[model samples]
Target chain A: MDIAQTSPAADYPATARTTPTRHLERAHYDRATVHAILDADFVCHMGFVADGLPVVLPTLYARVGERLYIHGSTGSRPLRSATDGLDVCLTVTLLDELVLARSAVHHSVNYRSVVVHGRATRVTDEAELTLALDALVDHAVPGRAADCRPADAKERAKTAVLRLDLAEVSAKVRAQGVGDEPEDMDLAHWAGLIPLDRVIGTPVPDPAVPEGTALPGYLRHLG
Target chain B: MDIAQTSPAADYPATARTTPTRHLERAHYDRATVHAILDADFVCHMGFVADGLPVVLPTLYARVGERLYIHGSTGSRPLRSATDGLDVCLTVTLLDELVLARSAVHHSVNYRSVVVHGRATRVTDEAELTLALDALVDHAVPGRAADCRPADAKERAKTAVLRLDLAEVSAKVRAQGVGDEPEDMDLAHWAGLIPLDRVIGTPVPDPAVPEGTALPGYLRHLG
Candidate 1:
């Protein structure tokens, strides 16, 4: 994950609202910046307007090249509405640390996030759906797609996978420790960063497994 | 955090879109279910429509009783629009485990999430603002509010704190292990759950602090 910290002077075009009104310097429009954040996160919050009111749902997603794939039941409102070519916004955020500051007003969190705005179209083609589902599984656990059984015809019929192209996107990032004013820097309060991270613990095998079956190699090397 | 495992039969009404369309049985409107998930999560994705486009931003928030407090710069778009009594949706999600099943379609992530749709109003009264700021601080690290300096008049003027009542809210949760069909349960593949959690690491002291200052007791007690 060797990410270059260049400024947001890249040529990637930004949508009208994706441009940040406040902290404009924190807004990035590079494809590398967007791809890195998307690949690092497994879950995203998909926002769409249902009945003229905005609805946001947390769901699993995977990023393959410039496209993001999301799967859900055909009976779900979000999936059904998306298949009708409804506009949607998908966001992925990874919290890095808690920024403790001298002044309460300056307290904030350090995070990396990517927000994508576009129309989500359902994937009705069976061949593309197979590739999309494989990308999703492999995204969570690399190489696990080859290890698991493919979805049968009946299972595929009941599932709906929505695809969103990453054309209008932006990444707002804040990685600094504290942004306190000079006057409050000397205040007698403990100020630093408490790093927060999501870690994979020791894997627990299923009870139905044959006795003494060893864990897969890819899962062992995930962390 | 003693939450009852009751169904959604409670009288807490749900908005039109918050009603689950697919798994109606997984929706719970009890105040306990919503509060517990809110208390456990430190950040939330706030969804709002800005200039006819839906925008979602990840921000820090705190749940105080029936009210949720979110603070940001007065210059930020979300905070300014929220203070103007605009409609907004805030969602908090905690991923419990990754359910690995025999078939790809059955793979899912177990999680608990709460979504609130309501109007946000500005908190301008000085006393209430102080209390809200304290809650936001203590929410991250309990009992640290009194240990730090309060927001001065100038800092409060530049910051905006918005409050949203938890009236139209619902908690969608999936806590069980894999729900594979009976025919696929006996398939020759490894199946189990991999739990996920956020853990706080050893606090790195601020370089400006006096040498040999011990870590706070509350932070040490935090898992």
Candidate 2:
């Protein structure tokens, strides 16, 4: 529940901007926390300034090593900004529970989030791009990269992969029960935590799949 | 599965920024689609342009009428930027399914997301602030605003609510089975969709709560 614990050896150095302005106690710069929050999810909200205004878009991303790879088309606006090395902020959030407090002002939601502030550059190296693209598909369903048909040369030419290093990264988390002032402890309002979990239902196969083909082990484990 | 169904009568006017450049078929501007996507989720990723760079933060939000309100501390950096009317982009995303395609390039996630771009101003009107604050709490749980203790004068003074009109908004969705090229359909890969759902679990009551709370009627309804 506490992400504030110190881990000097493996923690990412916190800069003035990444140190957090409010709730300083909830920020964690440890590498493990940052990677865990990023690896557990497949989608992310990428923020980049365009034309002196901020733009946010939800897209598919995967964390590989110390850099995060985000996928998009070559003509997409967000990805195009990174062609010249754009100053971007990529964020991933996982909501654990909803905290209900005795007072309205104290009401909060329990969540774990990692924010990366860096220059996102369009990946051009052939080897790195191949690895990043595989990580993206495996992020959604592990081990399926080898089973599926790899992108051909024509398809790969149109895809754009942006890489942002995990240099200025910080994880913020809020967990545990509600917090209410001692004076309001006796209030008659109901107070507690509503836990939420994401569950995967049965998979429906496409009609075109050949008969007698067994489901992959990775997906079987997902069930 | 189609969000592009046109309803020009109720659609928001799309400007140069809002009109999508890629995947033109999946973009939707109808007010009902935008409101539905916003109402079904409580957490959002807010993008703000600070110091000529983009910053993304995860926070709680609520939609009322034609505007969206976000609550934050008065000293928070993101909220402070809005004191003089800042340009912001707020996004809410709902993941529906994971599409497994025959080819790696075609792998995609089915999602419903709303993006709002406009000027965000700090709420100074007392009446509107009160309503926004209530909506913030109720967004977590219906009928929660009246049940909990309202914020006192001191608490209200420290809280800041930023209001952003539902203008320049658009909803983009990808909801369906896997989309793979006809040539790759006969590949030996398993292709389908893994449906995802958000299920609320049993509420965990705080230890300090009254022993005989009997769980409020609304909470019983949650179960």
Candidate 3:
């Protein structure tokens, strides 16, 4: 649909020219709006065609500047297909809550999501691979790149990383409270926002870990 | 790859004869698990093939028992293709937190997700359509079906609800603490787990809601 240039941010219906967000009007999109949603997520659902069918796989991802780097084993079908210069669809979503309204018909949720359509190219450059890997690691753990062992040559060769430039991307989000009909307000139902959050906890070391290897400073009070 | 009968739940290598977990691991067959994950979610990525290329759309979804209903108009490409008996991959995920570890390589996120592969059929039966609509309403509001105005015949016919029977579905979850290496444990770095949870807040009614329509009891303390 060439969603990159045509899809409008706050005006989803005019952009997509359809009713993809009919039920939950708040969960609609624009260009730059969707990019910000995608940036908040660390994993994505990568979809591709295989043997004349569709396949979707979940994998960890990292955003490097404007490009998305997805790593997997070279033998993985999705990775292999992406590396073969095939078209791929990448999606990231954050489910904020399960909205419960006074009236069932007006029930909805609050969320943020992004979908990207593009052709992924296999990353082969040694330096780019190193930097991408580092970015991924750092994204997951801020200062762990210097603490852990780097991927050896064999490890690097066995792993496959695909780069999908965020050229054609669209984001959609739904936030706020329920939309109940005016007559249904005093139906003796509770209505309000139940905020969902992700919090970091105390780390549990592997049972076989040797003593004296203290936790890194960045990991102490992380969210 | 057919994941229906493959089970190597113990971190073993994938083998041809491996029996996939018949219960928790077999993501495509369990209806309850699929509905549980879907009910708790707010967004999903619908993956399909268009013009010999792959495309993914981020959209809202609602679950009604064994059938998962996705709503859209009659003109959407993916919806149209699904109505034609094409296989579709729908994925829903909830990201809990960013796992920070002592070592970069050990960092990961705590998440729960479900991926389903099936052919979508256009909902045509009147009884099923009504039930699906009610389920969609209840999915968004725990006790909403009884409070709001029912959809008239015209409203029902205008909305296209695509039904994908719960078939081959699996839920993959990674939770708990970081996975630090033995040698990196005592490096004087703080290590712990970050907990992520979806919290439901008090519902807020639309400004135009009439007085005396109290909130439903189930929604008062919903999770």
Query: By DockQ, who's the top model here?
Result: 2
Q: Please tell me which model should have the higher TM-score, number 2 or number 3.
A: 2
lDDT of each: 0.81, 0.86, 0.65
Can you list the residue pairs that collide in candidate 2?
A: none
TM-score of each: 0.92, 0.95, 0.77
Assess candidate 1 and give its lDDT.
0.81
DockQ of each: 0.65, 0.81, 0.36
Tens-digit lDDT track of model 2 for A1-223? 1113334358888998898888888899988888889998888999999889999999889887788889888888887767789899999999899888889987888899999999998888888889989999988788989989988898889999998888899999988688899998998777889998888888878888776767899888664
Q: What is the per-residue lDDT of model 3 for residues A57-175, given as tens digits with 9 covering 90 to 100?
A: 67788777567788877876666666567688888877676555565445556777777777898888888898888877766556666666677787688778888876666566777
Any runs in candidate 2 off by more than 4 Å, and if so which?
A1-8, B1-9
**Which residue segments of model 1 deviate by more than 4 Å?**
A1-11, B1-11
**Candidate 1 docking class:** medium
What are the per-residue Cα lDDT tens digits for candidate 1 across B52-163? 6677778888887778888888988878776568678899999988888888888888899999998888888888788888999989878778877788888789889998
- DockQ of candidate 1 is 0.65
The deviation in Å at residue A223 for candidate 3 is 8.2
Give the winner by TM-score.
2
